[model samples]
Target: MRNLTQTVTRWAPTGTDAAGDPIGYTRTEILGRWEESQQLFTRSDGTEAVSRAIVYLASDVAVGDFLLQGSSVSASPPSTAWRVEAFRKVENLRGTDSERRAML
Candidate 1:
């Protein structure tokens, strides 16, 4: 059997705007998977944008376990929410025997 591990990190905006209006955003990063690879998507200022998403996998992350941050936007809330528009695979590490071996 093959042992597979995956981790995702996401961010979103949750706070009041300049006029004290509620707003939010979202983003996600996935590792050790084929369909969803290393990529980060985000929406800021009510606009959507895509950028290179980088991630590192360690033994600390387990399935169904997620780390989240949240706070007030006006006061530079330590926890901000971002909106996720889309995701694409920029790099994949799982392939044939030789490719897998090279990764190790």
Candidate 2:
């Protein structure tokens, strides 16, 4: 296991309302290794996105959802919410699943 130093708050997607506004979110706290990096990844829509941070955890994260700094996750999320652009399961050199990675 990695030495996870940060707590990341995830806002799981709940379907929007008829008005196109977000109805609600299922929030979860993830303890993970957070790193600030510049990386390119493909979105679900086949578009390229530059990720500002990468989070490694043992839990699964959904693409199209939102992530926030744990300290900044309050009643209302911060304006700089990072939308989950991609997700990948990392494997170790032994060909075993290691961790879940989220590109934000």
- Each prediction's whole-model lDDT (CA): 0.32, 0.79
lDDT of 1 at 21: 50
**lDDT tens digits, residue span 1-104, model 2:** 56877888878767788887677787788777888898998887899989899888768888877887665445434577788889988777898657788998
Candidate 2 Cα deviation (angstroms), residue 6: 1.2
Cα-based TM-score, every candidate = 0.21, 0.79
Report residue 10 deviation for candidate 1 (angstroms). Answer: 1.7
lDDT per residue for candidate 1 within 11-87, as digits (tens), equals 33455589865465333443332232434344333554443322233222321122222223232223332223332
**lDDT score of model 2?**
0.79
Candidate topping lDDT:
2
